[model samples]
Structures are given as structure tokens and as C-alpha cells.
Target: MEPDVLGLVAGALTTIAFVPQVLRILRTRSAHDISWLLFGILAVGSAMWLWYGVRVNSLPLVVTNVITLTLQLSIFGLKWRYGRGKRP
Candidate 1:
């Protein structure tokens, strides 16, 4: 390995890790198991990371955080739409 390759691998793993939760929520239309507050925090954090990436010109960081932000936002939307009033 190259550093760029390592970054890509890490980025892929971290970003794709959220896929299962997103898929489950989409398929089952249930986001009761996920915390909305947590997702909101994650979205904000990811946005910050994206900003950092842009400032630092780190392609891996920018790409990964962008994808993660999208996925997390999707989860937040689903939770708001379907998990409203549900506690878990």
C-alpha cells in the first residue's frame, strides 16, 4: 500500500457501513431502533468533516463524509417520517 489506497479503503468501509441500517429502514419502513438525536448529531458532525475536508483538500475525507452525510440524512428523514411518536 499506498496512502491514497489506504484512504480509499478506509473511506469505503466507513461509508458503506451505514448501508445496512439505511437498507433496513427503507425496506421495513421502521426507524424506531435509531435515535433521531444521534442521527442529527452525526449529520452535523459529518457536515463539519466535509467542511474540513474541503479546507484540507483531502479527497478521501471529502468523499467519505459526503456519502455518510447523505446516508445519515436519509435515515433522519425516514425516522421523522415513520418513527415519529415511536420510542425505543
Candidate 2:
């Protein structure tokens, strides 16, 4: 397999890894157990990686991280909304 092909394969796998979690959250309509700190770090880190990908003009990095960042942010949104009242 070529390098690009390998990258795509890896990207696809990592990208899809979040799918089940996202689906579960959406299906159940709950994110009560998620940690805000963890998701915040993930979103910020992924956004930085996205910026880096854009800076270096790397297609795989840009594409993979874009999806990752979006997923992380969405999870974060759910985490925030659903996690709020549970603590009290």
C-alpha cells in the first residue's frame, strides 16, 4: 500500500472510532458521564492540530482532524448541557 493509502486507512479508522460514541450519545440523548475537562482538552488539541495541518497544507491531517474536532466539539456540547444538573 502507498503512503497516501496508508494515511487514508489510518485516518478512516481513527475518524470512525468516534462514530459509535457519537451515535450512542445521540441515540440515548445523554452525555452525563463525559468529563468536560477531558473533552475540552481534546477539542483544543484537535483544533491546534487542525491549524497545524492547514498551516503545512497536509490533506490527511486537515481532513482527519477536522472530523475529529467536530466530533469532539459536539460531544463537548452534549457534555456541557447534560452534565450541568447532574452534579447538583
Q: Which candidate comes out best when scored by TM-score? A: 1
Writing each residue's lDDT as its tens digit, candidate 2 over 23-54 gives: 88888777777777887888898899889989
Global lDDT scores for all candidate models: 0.89, 0.82
* Least well predicted 10-residue stretch by lDDT in candidate 1: 79-88
Q: Model 1: which residue pairs collide? A: none
- The estimated TM-scores of all candidates read 0.90, 0.84
- TM for candidate 1 is 0.90
lDDT string for model 1 (19-72, tens) is 999999889988777887788898999999999999998988998898999999
Provide the global lDDT of candidate 2 against the true structure. Answer: 0.82
